[model samples]
Target: MGESGTGEARPPSQMIDERIRELGDWRGDVLSQIRALIRQADPAVIEEWKWRGVPVWSRGGIICTGETYKSIVKMTFARGAALQDPSGLFNASLDGNTRRAIDIHEGEAIHPEALKALIRAAVDLNMSRTRR
Candidate 1:
């Protein structure tokens, strides 16, 4: 499809660019950081705006998602419950069964190495799932 304003054709999955452009100010920083992390971790991974308010990356299956709220940026892994999170970054919510999240507060620092490890693990996990 073509971009609404630019009229330049884009891949189907990237059609969500418009939604990303519409994200409010509160979410911009978080989204930028998430995109940077994804690019640093794997330059080849495909990024798509999904779930209305999240940045989603995928290879064989969904890798992870980043969402923003008033005070925090949350990164979630689709199969997070299965990942070996030695850093204890995974936050197990009371209502979920296969997802895990890491919340980053304003002014807080995110460990790039740790984030990259998690990203790599997520990609590997998705690849393994597709192989089965």
Candidate 2:
């Protein structure tokens, strides 16, 4: 499941594990939690390492990316602007024309069901475009 953007054949999952372990703090915890949720949401989701260190998930098409900052763990959906967010989980990158993101802080709590719905929606969106 590990696909390298730099032509490296290393498993992306291993790289992600190293990144998470490197964080070794709350941000790591948050990232790990969200990663688990994403995997749970789509069992077939592929884990990839992009831009050298970013954790990306894709299926049919790009679904989302996991990026961590000092104060937040950002999950940016590839087609977020096209998905419905009735739960209002998207609190960051709200002004983009075609993308959306959820910025989670150290103590922030994520709505698992809502996030699962979002992941499913992203997958559906990707699949829809691929079918065309």
Candidate 3:
């Protein structure tokens, strides 16, 4: 179960929906867009609410996490360091050994196709690993 800010326990999918509603701002819009792209890229992707309030997207393993903060919405990829980001969508956590993140601020425009490509690549990476 995922806990809301109010400390109420609920299903992760339901909690994620409420979190999007609760944001009620540009962050919500960005997160929503990201979610849509992820779903478009991989229809089989699973959404899980983890680390208390974060929105996590996974396939064979974690693909990325959506973390909304005061100034930005961060999408952190679990094996981002190993992925080839030709579009350079990842702008945060670049120095990390295992993860990479894309930080979107207010009014920032996301490249739909580029993000979808990234999401697909992440899913492929997870699937390949699981097959081993």
Highest-scoring model, TM-score: 3
Q: Each prediction's Cα lDDT score?
A: 0.72, 0.91, 0.93
Q: What is the TM-score of each candidate against the true structure?
A: 0.77, 0.92, 0.93
1-132: candidate 2 lDDT, tens digit per residue: 344678768888888898899999998888888899999999999998898689999999889999999989999998899999999999889999989999998888889999999999999889898898
- Misplaced by over 4 Å in model 3 are 1-9
**Tens digit per residue, CA lDDT, model 1, 1-132:** 244467775663454444346665545556666678877988878876655435678877888887667787778788888788877777545257788888877777777788888888988888888899
Q: Name the top lDDT candidate.
A: 3
- Candidate 1 local distance difference test against the native: 0.72
Stretches > 4 Å off in candidate 2? 1-8
lDDT of 3 by residue, 1-132 (tens): 455579977776787788899999999999999999999999999989887689999999999999999999999999999999999999999998999999999999999999999999999999999999
**Least accurate 10 contiguous residues by lDDT in model 3:** 1-10
Model 3 residue 123 CA deviation in Å: 0.5
Instruction: Return the clash pairs for model 3, or none.
Output: none
- Worst-scoring 10-residue span by lDDT in model 2: 1-10
* Rank order (by TM-score, best first): 3, 2, 1
